[model samples]
Target: MAVRAGLPRITARVHLDLLQSEDGRRTAAELTRRLKVSPASVSVAVNYLVRHGYVRRERDPQQRRDVYVIDDEAWYRSVVLSARQTLETARAALASAEGAGPDDLVGQRMARTGAFLERISLDLLESADRWRMLLK
Candidate 1:
C-alpha cells in the first residue's frame, strides 16, 4: 500500500525485499518463480523501478543473465522524504491555526495535533537509525 502511494511500483518493493533476503541479485526467471507471477508482469515492474531510479540491472559476467539490484539508500531516502513531507504538512496546518489565536479552541486542538506529529516524526527518524544499527 505504501509503495503504491509512492514513486515505486508495488512489485518493485516486493522484488527488493526478496533480493535483500536472498544471497545475490535475482534474475527474472528466479523472481517469477519466487513471486509466482507472470514473466511479463515481473518485466514491467522491473522496468518501472529501473526507469524510476529505484533499482539497477546488470548482466552476470559468466552467465549473461540479468540481475536486479535494489538501491537500499534510495529506498531509505524515499521513505524518509515521505515521512518528512507528511509531518511538515501537519505542522503547517497546526501553525496556521495557532497563529490565528492561541486562546481559540481550534488553535488549542491544532497545537496538540502538532505535538503528536512532531513526536511521530522523531520516532520515525529514530527507527531508521535503529534499523541501520541492527544491520551493523
Candidate 2:
C-alpha cells in the first residue's frame, strides 16, 4: 500500500513492518532481522521514511539504539504533508498558466489542472481534519 502510494519498495516494507509491530516501533537491527534485509538497506529506508514524515526516529534509552516509530498520528501527518505538496504543485501550475497568456490553449489546460489540484488539496486537508476529530 505504501509502495502504491509512491514510497520505495524497501521503505514501504519497513513502514509496514513497523506499523504491524506490537509497539509501533522497531530498531534498525530488528527491522533488518525481521525483513531479511541488510542493515544499510534498513537505514536508508528508515531515513527516507523519517524525512517524509511517515516515521519518526527516537533513541531507545535503555538499548542506546535508534528506534523507528509509526505513531497513531503518522497517517494524519503524511496526508497533511502530501496535501501541502499538492498545493505547491497547484501554485506552480497556476503561475505557469499566467506566464503562458490567458488565451493560449496550454495556458487554459494548465489553469484547469491547477484549479483541480488546488481543490483536491483543500479537500484532503479538510477530510484529514474531520477524521482527526472523529478519531480523537
Best by lDDT: 2
Global lDDT scores for all candidate models: 0.72, 0.90
lDDT of 2 at 110: 94
Give per-residue CA lDDT, model 2, range 1-136, as digits (tens): 6678688999889988998999888989999999999999999999998987878999989988998898678789888988999999999999999999899999999999999999999999999998986534
- Runs in model 2 deviating more than 4 A are 134-136
After the best TM-score superposition of candidate 2, give how far the Cα of residue 109 lies from its true spot, in angstroms.
1.4
- What would the TM-scores of all predictions be? 0.59, 0.88
Top of the candidates by TM-score: 2
Steric clash pairs (candidate 1): none
In candidate 1, clashing pairs total 0
TM-score of 2: 0.88
Model 1 C-alpha lDDT per residue in residues 1-136, reported as the tens digit of each score: 6467664464755556555755546788878888777888888888877766566888899997888877656556555766687689778868877796788888888888888887888788778766764333
